[model samples]
Target chain A: MLNIGQHISQEYNDELEDLRNQVLSMGGLVEQQFSDASNALLNGTINIAQRVTELDYQVNAMEVAIDEGCAQIIAKRQPTAIDLRNIFTVIKVVTDLERMGDESEKIAKFASELSADTNSMGFYKNLKHMTFIAKKMLTDALDCYARLDAKKALEVSNMDAEIDAEFEILNRLLSTYLLEDTKNIESILKVTWCARSIERVGDHAKNICEYIVYVVYGKDIRHVIDGKLQDDK
Target chain B: MNNNKVELDQQLSETVGKPLINGTPKITCRDVNVFYNQDSQAIFDVNVDLAKNQILAMIGPSGCGKSTLLRCLNRMNDTIDGCSITGKISLDGEDIYSNDIDPVLLRAKVGMVFQKPNPFPKSIYDNVAYGPRLHGIATNNSELDDVVEESLIKAGLWKETKDRLNKPGTGLSGGQQQRLCIARTIAVRPDVILMDEPTSALDPIATATIEELMHELKSSYTIAVVTHSMQQAARISDRCSYFHLGRLVEVNDTNIVFTNPEHELTENYITGRFG
Candidate 1:
């Protein structure tokens, strides 16, 4: 973890610590929203699905609050070096977290539509597996952010591939279900939409992990091949 | 963390970034060391270059030898008893400390402004004309008037001080006085200007004015500034050097120094993590 304290001014140290804690607090909320949305999809619970949609406004509010905090730090502290990088990373990570909340809400909307037919639960076995992997990826990415562990961040970022592969398998299974009977096309499409939303959640989790690496190493690893940085390699 | 300190010290035995710029520099200091007397050392081996037509800012904590090194550039430290320097400091390929070189003439080429506004107790016009008259730069009164007006204009004080040319320079505001001092330095047409905390005694508006003037001045002369304000360095300098405990810790482009300094000491200082 980064030692952000040791500033000559204790108040400045407190300000930086408060800023980081605010980011973690926002991450916790977003992670809970994702988990709740995943549970609604797996269990076909309308109440939990509606709850996810309502909670998205809170996530959006957190993004705006955290963005204002960053602007305040830049104005008052004039942070440089790692302090500057950390604030910049927090701004980017907050955006990804908010988008993740949006994706989770999409999953909940589709999950609510698919809840009418309990027989559709059998088709979601593959989606259930994908949700498990994606939720774990998000958990690990948040853990990496809290600890400032670049190595673990890289590991979590690589796990996005596993989520992607699971999505592909789920897509193939859904295609077969569609071809076998045209009667279930409408329900199968909802399942496909839920699966796509889960895949997008994994991508957003990967983005958060990349931002952690940026804060620790002061290097932007986005769009880089194989997740290898120049010095890390 | 203690182990990291040991590793950092080992790394800091030499400068961490490119201190010597490529191409012919306006001023160069090679293997420079300063000593106050036989037993005490004020500066370690520092090798840096001031590129032509750019501003180089030297930044560090108080008593870190940034001011000492700035004084060495113009031999301002020569007045201090028992002070000695060992290095090759050259201006335009000629050693300034050589026996054949006159310190008076060298000072004219490498002029300086100080922390406090120390304009002489003469009129504004005379203060600007003092350097030219002393150096015999202008032969007649009209030529001297031209030099004074041009220097004041270059320093961004002509519009404000033109009507009051006969007023005592000491009667102006702190910022204006500093600008008048700058005009006095440039009156002799120096190739380089050294400023030691030139805006330390001024307000924000004044500091902004001087920073803007420095940006304009860089097109014609090389500038080296010693400042305690890291924001000032970030705003005005093209290159920046970080010093710590009498050692040159790092030197790099101003953007790199502020955003991603390579040396830990520089990072700590700039981020307010310094002990």
Candidate 2:
């Protein structure tokens, strides 16, 4: 008889736990990539940039692994309610983290190219600041997911505004630098592109935070109607 | 999943001997089984709870034990040789297995309808009046007439069969005969009605009528039906149980069990796997 309280096997639970661990490992790797790329930009190191580029493949593989794991769980376990939510969250988080990994690699590539130039661009300082904050936001988003903390996720969303403001400042500073020294336009353009890439990373971090909110609160905050977080209270 | 299984086992153990209050089941097993004779047991332990006035469905492949388990509700399996029951099944604080209890009287409280329309091969009115007359629910012919008309009306076939009360029940079409059978079951005024593949022999229109009738009947009587069609179970049941290989794989709210089953066996069966 299939009673509500009947004993399920340990093998099934272990499999689910293993999948959860795999997703968390993937999240950790993507967060590490984000940090490595930012550190490369800060230190102007080609080796760290090269490492970030190489890790993108691992992130891609993890994405495929997480997708396959979720499919197997849905096929074999027939999870419901909270269990369903957990598998779905893993799927979505892996996708967002993969995109974040891609953006980080782009940042690393931009850093490697800019390392060859000796120009002491003032905008690099602002880029460093942006990268630092963006990396922190990404890290905190991952932490929120690991702890399943909804409040920390909301804090990460608020941090996105600071990254956006930094991007706007970087844009204005680059325009000013271009007009003052037209000969340095190529270098300034690289800086602008890197800034845009960092801005995109910030957006993805916000998306991760939103996903964390979903995991913790079971609410979809994306495309919030009327510019308000739905009244979850 | 292992932890959940242990917790669920604990919950099931805790529920043992808890009586159903006021005909409301804390848990109802329709066609539950315990077999000691077969190489592979044919009947499964099927658990279904008809909460007060709600409808529950037992659906799965042929030989999945949907019908065998349904028959266990009123100790219908006592008639079958070599069948043993170990599970504690109760109705309103009274264990049906108590020594003082009678299977025939228990069946009166929990009536059953079969897949093929078995109308006792009697007249239309007689078929409707059979159960009440046998149980002595009415004292006179006039009281019997009231019981028959009320049962037919409750079965939604009174207007169609009113003028033909004297006609043989076998003369009606397949749909009308099934309704007559339903009216007979209703005449007993059972607290819960057990239906085993109630529409498998009927046409589509007849099936639709029966399904609609079930919705109306559930307002007053708890119902547990076993069907081969997953769609029919999803359509008419508030809750559903999926059985496989003499074991209940899963049971839950119909929407979740159908759309997102929690057991591998249930998902495989629902998605047309090995059934």
Candidate 3:
């Protein structure tokens, strides 16, 4: 739970709790943005696409605010040990969240471009499946961080491989489509860009999961092979 | 409830570091214990090495034995009636408890600054000159004047108090007064300086000045500061030792102690999870 009560000074406890709540709120906002952008892309509605782009500014603003909060806590409270790790994790996690929001906005813009042609909507089945898996990975990543659950974070981290494989399929399909059809090249390229954006979002989600593992176990799990991390003491 | 509290107290009392060894220790303490009236114990088996020309801050809650342990460095606890200290403490490889070693002379080499700014009600110049007068550090009038000015300069107070050398030491500001005391300590050219919450009374700006002075001072004098201010300890000290219930809980590099403490008791104390 990352509970930090019982401090001699309760206000310090309150400030730490408030910082965590702010990060969770930002994560929650990015999570909603991910869902809305997915819906906007599949539906190819201009209104929803516009909403997705506009909402990104909020995510960006939250990142700045949360970053400032972390700085203030470090300067004022001088958190140590697990509290320091938790604050450091929040700083790293928010960067990933903002990047995820950026990808979602990019996907929405692609959806807006494709929506102009009714036939292009049929191509969304693969994108739909990809977004579904990516969103699930992101959800699990956020949940594990909220709980500081290393086990769940590892699970979310493993799911990134599936998204990576799907993205390979995406890259293949996009190249093949371009080879088969010259007239629809511009619109097909938008689809390819959208797929790449969503795949990058999956990578960022995986990065967040890695940070969660570090926070929980004090071990850097990034760039590791076969789920192995040297347990740093 | 009683049993649970006892268990929790036992957990918190579990000492972590064993025969702490690091950089060339200026003052080495081994298995030191303090007791009042032979029954009321104030400290447990504690061992720490205060590295040469470095600052080691000892921190914990109120009555956590941080101050008691700091006092052991200069044997300040010996003055208290019924207070007894056991175990070995050496300075520069020489046993401080040796029969030939005088406690009065030992204090000159190991000076101390108290929680409050205690400037003797004498002239500012005399306040700084008192140590050298007693220790005979300066041979002549010119040498004493040089000593007074140098010590005040090192304390970061010479510029402010130079013109007003004859003013009552108590007339200076709280921060200036603390610096004056520090100057007095340095006049004797002490090898080690023990500070007991040296800046708790000063304003933030003043506290900052003393903290900065500590950095400059560590180039010559080893400092062991007992502070309730955690942030100050993190900012100024080279190493940190967390003490709780008379037991030495942990000692490590200041950065490591602040970011990745080893003991559960140390963790709980620094993280403010302690009661």
Among the numbered candidates, top TM-score falls to 1
Pairs clashing within candidate 2: A5-B8, A5-B9, A8-B5, B31-B69, B31-B70
For A110-144, candidate 1 gives per-residue lDDT tens digits of: 87777787657886778888888888988888888
Calculate the i-RMS of every candidate, to one decimal place: 3.5, 10.0, 7.0
Residues A26-76, model 2: lDDT tens digits: 878887888888777768766888888788999899899889988997887
Off by over 4 Å in 3: A8-22, A39-51, A54-80, A116-129, A176-181, A218-227, B1-14, B17-19
Question: Looking at candidate 1, what is the lDDT of residue B229?
Answer: 95
**TM-scores (chain A) of the candidates:** 0.93, 0.88, 0.92
Candidate 3 lDDT over B1-275, as tens digits, reads 11111234456444554336666778998888899999999888888888898899999878878898888788788799999989889999888877888888889999999999999989999999998998888899999999999999999998998899999999999999999999999999899999999999999999999999999999999999988888899999989998877878888888877876767677778887754
Q: Is candidate 1 or candidate 3 better by TM-score?
A: 1
> Given candidate 1, what's the lDDT at residue B145?
96
lDDT of predicted model 1: 0.88
| Candidate with the greatest lDDT versus the true structure | 1
Give residue B152's lDDT in candidate 1 (0 to 100). Answer: 96
- What's the distance in Å from true for residue B208, model 2? 1.7
lDDT agreement with native, every candidate: 0.88, 0.76, 0.83
lDDT of 3 by residue, A131-194 (tens): 9989998889888877777777888888888888988887787788789888888988888888
